[model samples]
Target: MMEIQGIDLSIIWSIIIAFGIMMYVILDGFDLGLGILFPFISDAQERDVMMNTVAPVWDGNETWIVFGAAAMYGAFPLAYSLIFEALYLPLIFVLAGLILRGVAFEFRFKATAEKRHIWDKAFIGGSVLATFFQGVALGTYVSGIPVVDRQFAGGAFDWLAPFPLFCGIGLLLTYALLGSTWLLIKTEGMLESRMRHYSRPLAYLLAWVIVITCGWTAYLQQDIAQRWLHGSHWMLTCAVVVLAVIALYGLQRSLRLRHSHKPFVATLGLVFLGYAGLVISIWPNIVPPSVDLWQAASPTTSQLFALIGTLFILPVILMYTLWGYHVFRGKVQVGDAYH
Candidate 1:
């Protein structure tokens, strides 16, 4: 395997894939959260404003997931195949939800008043379904898949467990909180105030869920628990917890101060911290319990080739994404339309 400064190409690819997934989560998460928040918003104009806030950048945000998946396929074909095999059902449902949501997002604007409510329902249902199943997939992955000889050996319904279900609910709340903080940044007047009101409770619920999920995850997987609680790993765990507390405190302070951007920034910090913790817990394991990065990685030649393309393309994606957000930077009004 090729090495750069003694670091394996597989490890580098792992980092790239992880970064892509993180970008997807933080970027698309808020838009998905907007859909989840749709039910709470009764006023048609308010919903319009909420949708418009994300309309300019939402579709572009999904590019990261595609990037991540493609990177995995090119750089870690073994792990990619195994993971997809294990997660086939949930992944299919995730695609379905995304399709539904995308269709609703476009049609909702074009629909008449009578038909708009149907699209509204589609948006909400799609968002909830996608978020929930994504969580289930995460939980299932964390719990470990049964892989035998590089093939998935698990049952199709293995994901339908208590832990995964709780995770599904937890993720729903997490996205709702993200959406609320995002609204705080992109809105004003009564909508902003309502989002502010919603943000606190959502944050509180998310905090509880995070704590419980951590404990549950630890209890359910001894290897992970040892990784988190034993040896020098405990310090990293402490740092993550400290950072989480700080983020939570900052969020509350920002909300109290009525600072629009700070709340969203703090929320992003919390999400990053959680994502960092997950990576730390499962470091080097592209597929836990068996497959390490090296085991799952494609040939060094393939990884190097893909890495070159990724290096060239990733910056372009980032540049344009930033440009889009910059162009649309402002409070979205009711009449605003990105479609």
Candidate 2:
């Protein structure tokens, strides 16, 4: 690998970390959003159709999260140690919920008439639980992951604080908004119309949550707040502004058009922008004030080693993702089966 001021590995590795997390957010995020939209759906047929909307891609979507975590562990051992130690219980719950949702999703179709509701409940419950915990985790990121003496020095339940709780709710609303948009694009008839009707309101709600969370985050970390509110972090602030505009405009356009992919993509752009804001807000600090990307990054040799595999696999993942979506393009008929 090329070396520049001996910082060659750091630059490449930072890109890798950023890319991995972005991939996770963009990929797993929607499926989690799909789960969040679960309760909004009425009628068993509509729920099944909603579930089917994501069935083909949901599992594939979640893979990026695993890829992200694995990349963190491999590239930034220190960050992995700190985050894993601090977020262990919540992570466990998150994994369990995801597992339950994945299994129950498949099993619900095969379940006997008597046990079908059981599976349905499992699916919904699992989705809610998983999404909530993941949101809580996001809040923890904003609140700061606990660290002491270069190691995680906080309780497992530290993630369950009040601010994190609010963040969890915010994430729930955001995911629901995404699911609603996806429904507008993927399904048709009354269900799609209902989903479209729900989109703007849900997006508005999510925007409220975002404002509240930003305020709370600023309150908790005055310095970070100043950085965000002031013109210090101009680029990231610009991203947030752009995201807000896109989200609002896209929602309006989608509402007018009734069903189009642009709004969904715009919603995804909002997600990207939101995540970028968070990352920028916590610059030079991975766990905040305790560790940074450079501090947490592995040695040059290991990073280089991993880059080889990443270079090969990343394209393949992208190709398959695009191909899958391409093949599944157009509205899905409710009578059609997910499997």
Candidate 3:
């Protein structure tokens, strides 16, 4: 265990927690987004291809969520309590959707064509519900978590506000971009070509929505703009912009060259850069201006206890994820082949 200005070893654990959450969002988020875009494929064969694109990896991908939640519960008990209490309904909905989707995922394989159609719809619905609510939860945090004496003072619908709603839409488009990129990488021929064509237009639209949403957010909370533009945090905004430009250009070139790998890799980089910008821009504030990291964290002893297990488990998870992807890294097939 190391110390930073005599801060507890738990701070490292907090970093791990943050890392897990962001990683989960970027990894599992694309698959969920792909699942969300399932309905748009129109053709059942293409839909099956999309489904197979993520089937092998989706369940494993969700492990990060567990890691993140456990880390938060152990290292930041206050934050865990506050978020769960405040966002109980949304969390419940997210969990329900995830469970339904997971079940529907397997059921779709066993069910007949008609029953499979129902399960497919269920999976898509579940994915959308979970994805949208996750966005709403983030939006609530951005807008600020209502607090009174370290407890939630807001209603259940507090997260469904206008700014949060826009953020939700932003998240939707963001995921759609992710889905398109995944399709570009995982499929070939006509489907891959279609995904490639769809990606740029979707990315452009998502970029527009994101810019407008950020502007709207700044308008709503003047401090966000003030901090983003004139404060010490301006560098993050520049970084995000530069990365976005690079990602866009790379995506354009990838489409032209029909590169299977470039677009997904570039999009992943863009997502990480954007997520990192958000994290840095809002550091030391777990629940924004009201709650600082240290104040939200668990006791040092409790954190040390959690660290023991995380240290053992984290590397295993990392190794397995890398190995799984390495094993499955190739063109996904449609029709009666196993994924």
Candidate 4:
């Protein structure tokens, strides 16, 4: 098997999965954020416009998660099993939420006034459930789930902890920030005005949660803290930190200056910064201290086949994704819902 400067196919596959995971979090994240922000909107027309902004492309956003999961299962079956076993309950809840969200998206548009409220609530509830549990699962992953003999050894409620709960709240606020910026771009009139007002505070709140979460993660994990604080890694960590700060400032500045695209761009930058930091801190180790990427990777033959298929298919996916976004581009007015 050929190697790219000693980096094997396994590492390449891992990077592919990592990129897919990041895309899922950032893309679908905004829609989930919008759904979570629904209760704050009392005006039904405003809510409809907000939902319409994401209607044409929301399901497509979720496809990235499926790609990520499939890559994980195929490329790193051991790590995937460990994660699934440890997170089975939260994963189940997340799936239920996604299903409910899909159903709510269709029914809300056709319902009577009173029934629309019910469907709207279902949408919001699903978004909240999914985002909160995702955060919780992340916290569990960061804090380290118990494993024995290559399997999850923790109880069902083992992930129920203060840090996970805080992470849940943090995720909710982060999504809210994304949703608000998204609304500012896709809406007009009083709704857009309200979103612009809310986006700034949400940005500030997201910054706070990010700071606290990073500090807590550092304090909590000795190995990660040591690696991140030492040598060139520390410098890279500092650079990422600076970028995060700039992103936060840009988000607020764009909101103030009424730049339609800048706020969302900056928001995506912040999300990427966080994802990069997490990946750097956990590099090589797909499941932290116990299992490195190489140890968990599938055989080289499997990886070669997968990589070949990925090379052929990924560009096509990217092209259509780009085209879809372009086709759906523009602000969603009150009565302009696609379906």
Tens digits of per-residue lDDT, candidate 3, 1-339, equal: 334467666568768988898879888888888877887777878888888887778999999999899888888888889888877887788898899899888888878887788998898988888888888777777777777899888887888688777777777777878888888878888888888888888778877876786777677667667777766578778878888888878877887788888887877777777677666546767876578778887767777777888889999999999998888788887773543
Per-model TM-score versus the true fold:
0.98, 0.93, 0.93, 0.96
User: What residue pairs are clashing in model 4?
Assistant: none
Question: Per-residue CA lDDT of candidate 4, range 1-339, in tens?
Answer: 335467588878888999888888888899999989898899988888999898888998998899899889888898999888888888898899999999999999889897899999999999999999999888888887666787777888867888877888888888888888888788889998888888888888889999999889888888889978887899989999999998998888888899888998999999899989988788868887578887788887787778888888778877877888899888888788646
Q: Whole-model Cα lDDT per candidate?
A: 0.91, 0.78, 0.80, 0.86
The prediction achieving the highest TM-score against the true structure is: 1
Better of 3 and 4 by TM-score: 4
Looking at model 1, residue 234 earns an lDDT score of: 93
lDDT of 2: 0.78
lDDT of 3: 0.80
**Candidate 2, residues 1-339: lDDT per residue as tens digits?**
334467677667667778877876666666777767766675778878887877788888876777778888887888888887877877788899899999998998888777878877887788778878888887887787767778777777889789988877887787777788887888889988888788878777877787787778888988677777676687668768777777778777868776578778878877877887887788767777568777888877788788789899888988998888888878888777866
Q: What is the lDDT of residue 52 in candidate 4?
A: 88
Query: So what's the TM-score on candidate 2?
Result: 0.93
Cα lDDT of candidate 1 equals 0.91
lDDT of 4 at 61: 91
Q: What TM-score does candidate 3 reach? A: 0.93
